[model samples]
Target chain A: MTRIEEAIKQSKFQDVYQKALVNLIYTANCLRDEQVRILKPFDLLPQHFNVMRILRGRHPKPVCPGEIKEVMLDKANDLTRLLDKLERKGLIQRNLCPTNRRKMDITLTQAGIELLEKMNHMMEQTHETLKGRLSEREAASLSHLLDKLRG
Target chain B: MTRIEEAIKQSKFQDVYQKALVNLIYTANCLRDEQVRILKPFDLLPQHFNVMRILRGRHPKPVCPGEIKEVMLDKANDLTRLLDKLERKGLIQRNLCPTNRRKMDITLTQAGIELLEKMNHMMEQTHETLKGRLSEREAASLSHLLDKLRG
Candidate 1:
């Protein structure tokens, strides 16, 4: 068993604050692990999924690399390199923004949309699997607490 | 403002979830950012800090890389590389076990312990800075929900 698993098994604290740090890191790792497994079949990483989602959000309206960077979940400094890899895979397109020569506009290719559609059910399943562990009320409270924690 | 900061201001639910994902990523990034900052003065990453803590837990008894992997929060597949990095920095030393040539025993050097000692208070400060936004009770609840969500 992992140290985190062991920590969970042995934890005596009813108050979560007592071990909030470990718990947050542990849970995020678990969520990311699940995402990695599902995304692997598509030859994508979590960062790639993040970029694709952002593109899809701005569908019909092209966005620049700077905008993508502002919204990226990982805020990777190496996004240009990551986008280069995605562009190489034909999952996305990069075009020069006519208005701003310095900015490169990014959009999802047809292949990228199809890939996201195919993975929709898997994404739902991943959330459903986790949702089973907590009630709706619990989930909302969790989300709320997380937001508050970030304040 | 960050994408998440803007998303929160816009109150976009779909954008909110996307931002929430980014928030989690950013929060983790921030914590790691602080950790890195604290560790830089000592020339260590959080992973290195973890290794030192593990070694201290089993002081006087050398641990193998495999044992360290089991207890590691990250459980990195590249432990060999991580160990190599630490060993290169003189924070840790490796000796082949008498019974198992395939396994090497790892122990902390005096420099490693002193480094950890110097940064111990700083580590607590890292947690304090993060918890500054939430009450103790809220932090505890957040931790609990995160753990339950992982299950």
Candidate 2:
């Protein structure tokens, strides 16, 4: 038995607090699995999806890599490398910002927009699949609690 | 604005859901960041910590690589590589199981145990730091809801 398994077998929680930590980590892992499957069909990882979404937000207006990094869901180690991959795939275009020599503006290509649109329904479907397990109020409360936890 | 930022700015329900997804991913990333910091001083990663705990669970009795994978919180792609790293570090030993020709049993070294003891306190401290954000009941409910969502 693993320590996790042992923990499960032992029922060692004196209170609900400890149990919550385990549950949070476990559920996040489970949700990630689901997201990964959905993303696989698009040949995209979650991080890629995140980047595309960021670029699409700026749509006509191009934004620099530094800004994207700031808002990125996960603070990626190598923005240049990740952007290079996407640019090589022709999903996005990178241009040098006129005002800032060091900053490069990134914009999604038409293919990227279309890909996101195609994936949007599936993403919604995935969310809905999990939604049945909790009420709106419960989900809202849960999100609120998570935010508080982070804060 | 990035697509995600616009999603947040626009309050699109689908976008909101995506934001929630990002929030979960980001928060977990931050938690791992903390774990990485703690583990770094000991020259470990979260996955390594996971392996050590598994070995400790089956302390006296050796466990097979397959069994370790079964209980690992993160499903690793290459167990052989990970085991090799641990073995090279002198933290674990692998022996072919007598009963099962294909199976290799893994056991932790005293060095592994001592390192784990030192790191466990740091993990608990990190958890405690986050614990202050939510009340005990809220945490339990959050866990319950997350489990239900995953299910």
User: After best superposition, candidate 2 residue A50: deviation in angstroms?
Assistant: 0.2
**lDDT tens per residue, model 1, A59-133:** 858888888887775678899999998899998999999998999989999998898888767887765665567
Instruction: For candidate 1, give the lDDT.
Output: 0.73
TM agreement with the true structure for every prediction: 0.88, 0.89
Writing each residue's lDDT as its tens digit, candidate 2 over A118-150 gives: 877787887777667667676667667767777
Interface RMSD list for the candidates: 4.0, 5.3
Q: Pick the candidate with the highest DockQ.
A: 1
Quote the lDDT for B45 in model 1.
84
**Candidate 2's DockQ:** 0.43
Candidate 2 TM-score, C-alpha based: 0.89
Please, what are the lDDT tens digits per residue for candidate 2 over residues B29-127? 666777889899877788888888878877968988887777676778788889898999998988988898899989998987887888887788766
Model 2, position A92: C-alpha lDDT score: 93
Error of 1 at A11 (Å): 5.8
